[model samples]
Each structure stands twice: as structure tokens, then as C-alpha cells.
Target: MPAFDLPRRLVAEALGTCLLVATVVGSGVMADTLTDDTALALLGNTLATGAILVVLITVFGPMSGAHFNPAVSLVFALKRDLPRRDLGFYVAAQIAGGIAGTMAAHLMFDLPVIEVSLKARTGGSQWFSEWVATFGLVGVILAGLRFDGKAIPWLVGLYITAAYWFTASTSFANPAVALARSLTNTFSGIRPLDLPGFVIAELLGALCALALMGWLLRQPANNTYSAARHS
Candidate 1:
């Protein structure tokens, strides 16, 4: 079957991103409330987020590469891989998805619209942390694409798992997630004031990944083009 068109892809990104943010952030808040210890909550949150991503990628990756993050799509565009015309569509979808997801989470969690708990950057080292976190995330995606993308889904899970701990900002590098998280002050909330900095950092990270992907994807003789054919 033919791949989904640009508009369809955007819709998928929007819906998928919304779900992703809701699950991740909601789990975090839920973890805080469980009678169980914080560790258990954290574990539950991580697993929930990871599992959802795997399913989302499997379901939507083929249609739109499941690029639930605007940074991811922009990176692909920078690489000349994505159709330039569709860039805006994908971004719009992701933004819409992010907001919608937060709205759903608010209702599900019984929290007001202003209480969404999103992960995000703060002052001081938090700025640098966002950049690094985004860099790592985009790197993972770009590198995965260079391969067969067979392990990408699994890798994404592992990546987020590690990112949750290692990065100072708790690795909330997803722009869609960030936007959705801003809607609430619950476990997933990231300060609205902090968003611009995060977005700038995320865009830079994606750009860096694009440069790396471009350089690495250069096939030698007989190697031909892998991504070209796939695209």
C-alpha cells in the first residue's frame, strides 16, 4: 500500500505525540501518588512511556515514521529526506497533538487544565542539560535510521529509560511533550516561561543530528543509497 500522504502523516504525528506526552507525564504524576514507593512509581512511569512508544512506532512509524516530535521531523527535513512542503503540516500536527494529549490527561487525572505535570528545563545547568538531552535523543533517531531501523523502536525505549535518569532535565527533550506538559502543573508540568529556551535547544540538537546523519549516511561505492530507497 502507498504510504500515508502528508496531511495524514501530520494527523498521525499529532495524535501519536498527544498520546505520548499524556502517557509519559501522566505516569509520572501517577507514580507520585501510588502507595508504593517512588521507585516503583518511577518504574511504572518509565515502562508505561516506553511501552506506549513501541506500540506507537509500530502502528504509526510506517505511515509517518511516527515522528511525534517536531524536532525529529525538522531534522529529517534538514537532511533533505522529508518533503519540504510537508514540514509545516507535520509540525502543526505535532503541536495540535501535544495540546490535545495534555487536555486528555487533565481529564483522566482529574486535574484542572492548569495542572498538567510536564518535564522541562529550569535555570542554571538546566539550559545546558536540555541541549545535551536533545542531542542524545536526536542522535539516537538519526543513528537508528542509518541502520535498518529494526532496533530503533526498542532503542527508543531504552534511550528514554536512560534519559530519564542521566540527563539533568530528566530528558524531556520532546517538543510536543514539552508543549503539552506546559498545560498542567502536575507531575508533567514544565514552566511555560522555560519553553522557548527548550525549543531553541531542541532545534539546535536536531540540526546537529541532521549534520551527523548526513555525513554518516554517505554510502561508499556499491553501498548506493539506503535511506534514499527507503524514503
Candidate 2:
């Protein structure tokens, strides 16, 4: 059972996601405005995202496990760590909070609150990148939980920081974040038309991670022959 009740947990999820998306979008906007070099702007955006993730997870992990992504929530539900009954509620909260975060960023930048993104981010390579990014993210999370739970924040933050540079899609591994980014026509935005492909790839990648990590993390049975020989 969770230390906090469902309502409080939901609040934590919503608030954490809200702040996370705000950082993502806001940082991208600020970086874009400050520099014309795409790589430098992306570096700035990545740093803020990775930094905020560490802070958000540390603050909210105890309350709601700090799953600000639907793919993450779904993976936990599949692992039976999170209640299946609450998965929908958690996803809803995450998506809502994510959209709100985009709007908040827009308001801060004096832009339209819900401008649909026209940034083209669709392609086979892009979809493949999403899969690879999400797969690594879920794998890292599960492995961190199995070994060093306390280090999960840093693990995830660093993984994403690296993934942003390594992946072709800039690693929009979170479905909620992908959807929210679709509503913004800023530096971080993705076209609404490209949303489904990213979301589907992310979900598939997460499930694949769950399957592989589930088997990999299980304890191996003792070998009777080896024990007998030692004896």
C-alpha cells in the first residue's frame, strides 16, 4: 500500500508532471531565444530537463513513485507494483498535467496557450529512436529498482541526458510529454500528426523493457550439483 492515499498520490503525479513539462518546454523556448545554434540550444534544454527530473523524483518519489509518464505508470501496473485499477487515473493525471505544463510555458513566453505544433518529427528513424529511448529508460528504471533504488533519480536523469544526444528523436520517451509537446509550436514541440507514432513506439518499447527486465532481474536458483561438489 502507498504511504499516501490515492487522491494525494494523484496530486503528486499531476504536480510533478506539470513542473517537468514546464521545465522541458520552458527551457527549450529560452534556449531557442538565446541562441541560434541548434546543438547549443538542445544542450541547454537537456540540462534543465535532467536537472528537474532529479529534483522532482527526489521530492515526489515517496508520495507517488513520481511516475510523470504514462509509459512509466503502465510499466509499473504491469509489474503489479502499481494497482491496475488506478492506472487510468494516473495516466489521466499525467496527460492533464503535461498539457497544463505546455500552456504554462506558453503563457510565460507570451505565446499562444494551445498552438498546435507544426514541427515535423515523423520518420521511420524517428520512431525507431523513440523505441530505443523508451526501452533504455524502462530498463534503467527496473534495474535501478532492483539494485540501487536510491540512485534511480540520478540514473534516470543521466540516462535521459545521454539519450537526448544519442537518439534521433531527441528521446520523447514519455507518452504524456509527447502529447503535451504536440500542443506547443515552440522549440520542443512535435507536430500533432506525429504524436500517435511516438506514443505507440514508446508504449511498445516500455513493454519490451518490462518483459526483458522481468526475466533478467529474477534470482537464479541454486545449482544442486555445484553445491554438492563444494560440500
Candidate 3:
């Protein structure tokens, strides 16, 4: 059984997600304000998000595994690390926290409480990019958990920072983040209409990674001859 209760874990997930999305949206807003250059704005957004991921994960990982993304939670649930019964609560908290974070960003910038994003992020390349980004994200998490658990925070943070530039959709690998970002007409926002594709791609990508990792991590068959020889 897990050390923390469901409610406490839920709170940690919510708070961590809220802070994470706030960092993403707020940084994007500030970056947009500070520069006309898209690359520079993206750089600022990437740095702020990456830095916050490291901090949030370090602080909240012990309590709830710091799964701010619903996709990540789903992966854990599939792996049976997270209770199947608790999956709904975790997803709810992540989505709610994501929305709240977007609202908080708007409030911080003196914008309206809610705004539908006009930014259209759709295309074959964009969808494919989301798939690749999410696949890499989950793959990194699974591999890191096996190899170097202590460095997961940095690994995730840095991976996201790099994915932001490499992926065409700027690597909104989290379903909740993609949905929440659709509410803001800012540098990091995506149109509501464009969100479904990204969400689907992300989910598929995560699922694929889980399946692949499961196969890859399986134990090798024991060799009867070798065992007899050793005996």
C-alpha cells in the first residue's frame, strides 16, 4: 500500500499541476510581452517550464509521484503502481488544476478570467510531433525509473525543454495542459478545435511507450543448461 492517503495524494497532484501550468502559461504571456521574436519568447517559456518541473517534481514526487499530466498518471495506473480506483480522482485533479492554473495566469496578467484560444495548431507534422514528444517523454520516465530514479526530475525537465524546440507543437505532451492551454489566447495556447488531435496523439503515444517498455523490460528466460552447470 502507498504511504499517503488518496486525498493527500490528490492534493499534491492538483497543486503540482496548478503550479506547472501556471509556469507554462505565465511564462508564455510574459515572454510574448517582452519580445516580438517568437524564438526568444519560446526560449523564455521553455526555461521557466523546465525549471519549475524540476522544482515541482522534487517537492511533490515523494507524496504523489508528481504526475501533473493525466497521461503520466494513466501510465502509472496501467503499470499498477497507481490504484485503478484512484485513476479518476487523479485525472480530475489534474484537469481542474490545469484550468485553475490558466485562470491564475490570466489573473496575473490582468486579462479576462476566461478566453478561448485562437491559436490554431493543427497539421500532420504537428500531430506526429505530439506523438513523438509524448512517446519520448514516457519512454524517458520509464527508463529513468529503472536506471536512475534520483535524476528523473532533471531528466524530465531537460527533456521537455528540448522537446519544446524539436517538436512542431512545442511539446504539449500533457492532455490536461493541452486542454487548459486552449483556454488562453496566448503564446502557448492552442485552438480548442485543435486540441482533440493533440490529446489523442499524446494518449496513443503514451500507450505505445508503455507497451514497448513492458516488452523491453521483461526478464530473459532462464537457461537450464547454464543453471545445471553452475550447480
Candidate maximizing lDDT: 2
Error of 1 at 104 (Å): 0.7
After superposition, candidate 1 runs with Cα above 4 Å error: 35-40, 116-120, 221-231
Question: On residues 108-163, what C-alpha lDDT tens digit does candidate 2 reach at each position?
Answer: 99999999999999999999999999999999999999999999999999999999
Q: Give the better candidate number (1 or 2) by TM-score.
A: 2
What shift in Å separates residue 203 of candidate 2 from its native position after superposition?
Answer: 0.4
Between prediction 1 and prediction 2, which has the larger lDDT? 2
- Local distance difference test scores for all models: 0.78, 0.96, 0.94
lDDT ranking from best candidate downward: 2, 3, 1
Model 1: ten consecutive residues of lowest lDDT: 113-122
lDDT by residue for model 3 over 1-231, one digit each (tens)?
349999999999999999999999999999999999999999999999999999999999999999899899999999999999999999999999999999999999999888999999999999999999999999999999988989999999999999999998899999999999999999989999999899999999999999999898776667965787799
* Model 1 score (lDDT): 0.78
- Find the candidate with the highest TM-score and give its number: 2
Query: After best superposition, candidate 3 residue 20: deviation in angstroms?
Result: 0.6
Which pairs clash (backbone N, Cα, C closer than 3 Å) in model 2?
A: none
Count clashing residue pairs per candidate. Answer: 12, 0, 0
**How accurate locally is residue 47 in candidate 3, as Cα lDDT from 0 to 100?**
100
Cα miss at 178, model 1 (Å)?
0.7
Q: What is the TM-score of each candidate against the true structure?
A: 0.87, 0.97, 0.95
lDDT of 1 at 58: 82
